[model samples]
Target: MGRSWQGRGRGRDMEYDKGGDNIGGASLKKIETEKGVIARFVIGRSANKGDSMDKSIDAENSQTDDFIILDNVVEAPEEASKKVKLFFAYAADRWDAQFYAKANDNIYVNMDALGSTLAAHLGKPRAYIGCMKSGEVFSEPNQKWYEPEWWKFGDKKAYFRHAYGEMYVITNALARFVSINRRVGSKKMGFQERTPLMVAAMYGSFGVLTYIISTGRSDVNRVSSDEKVTAHHCAVSACFVSIVEVIKILLDASTL
Candidate 1:
């Protein structure tokens, strides 16, 4: 990989303590691939007025404000492939962009790298997309491609399971990714093909439910390919009482 880095805002360099906590105003972490591919890593706390880091950390603890930059990464040697995979796995599962405030400097500085890296990895594209959405990676929906070629129709259903985990909020990034990848209406996930609506409903993500329904891409009335579950069925069975509005949205969309 190339050694050149285009540094953005000025940041202080602080060494990691034994426990791996950043001691200064901002933390700097460097990721070096086995073949010696190194990239800049920087994380900043969110400044959104009402956003809390605690609230974002749920049972799964899947979110973080850690904005990372890999766009400067040129190319990796063959030996570093495994290291790259491991890094993506850790980043996707541990530190997503869900709870961060929009327009933060860390995110703004590395938007292109963030989007490109997330889209390249298929193992947890949803998680990657969640992070990107949290950062508002793209101002317009059509500016980027968020999915890989392997994400066939039924794959999203399997992927939807991860959304229920902590830190995976229902952001426009998720919706936009599904729309662009043409996985919005897929029924191929499991023994029963659950649409995006059912997944959102089961996960009790009202924002995702509303957004998918508004897109008019999901078949709100269609039952699962095997289980015969509709979005309403998922809502009722999943006990999504907190989002009764989702039920209403699904109901209204069905009539149109």
Candidate 2:
């Protein structure tokens, strides 16, 4: 495992307290394996802005010499054998190019600290799955807006139930079949429309849980939308299934 420190801003100097804790310094730790590496970073309050910690940890793996960061954000159908850097961003800020430029010297942030924090949550003999949820803003159809329903009995219940069941089945089956991975996603939607960020944040947890359960070695059904069936976002069911499959492959390879 490799460790590093990172922080936010240019002018602020990180100060260590009597407990030897840096106010802004965030610590990073990378778990290296022959198949891939999972790098997690710990950040203090100063660095917890948006999804900053998440992006930074992803950057470590994406920025590495051996791995290839996909140009397309759209999920792909086929799985690749290349090593992956699964980043868990605990901080609230979005990690942009500017953050990467100052990754090496920010004293207030210790990346290792962040990694340790996550490790505690992950527990020993760690396993996980990667389930992703599109932000509510992106999922919203402008023309199809309606007031939130208290009881979605007719079509909504059926839809949510199916989604929930599928998710449960996939996660549970994958966990039973595989080993040593993480899974995550959001099971519910937030009430507020403007605060779509909360919904997006849920995806991280969902993805971790999905990954842990799938473990990169499970049978996944292809997503499709027919006349009788409709997905949350028109044609995203297949995309979701495919992503789970990809994680399954990655986890399987890692175990090998």
Over 4 Å off in model 2, which ranges?
1-67, 71-110, 126-154, 157-256
lDDT of 1 by residue, 187-241 (tens): 2211111111111111111111100011011112111222332333344324433
Error of 2 at 165 (Å): 20
Compared with the true structure, what per-residue lDDT tens digits does model 2 show for residues 116-175? 222333321222333333322222335353325424435343223211212211122222
Window of ten residues with lowest summed lDDT in model 2: 190-199
Whole-model Cα lDDT of every candidate shown, in order: 0.24, 0.24
Global local distance difference test of model 1: 0.24
lDDT of 2: 0.24
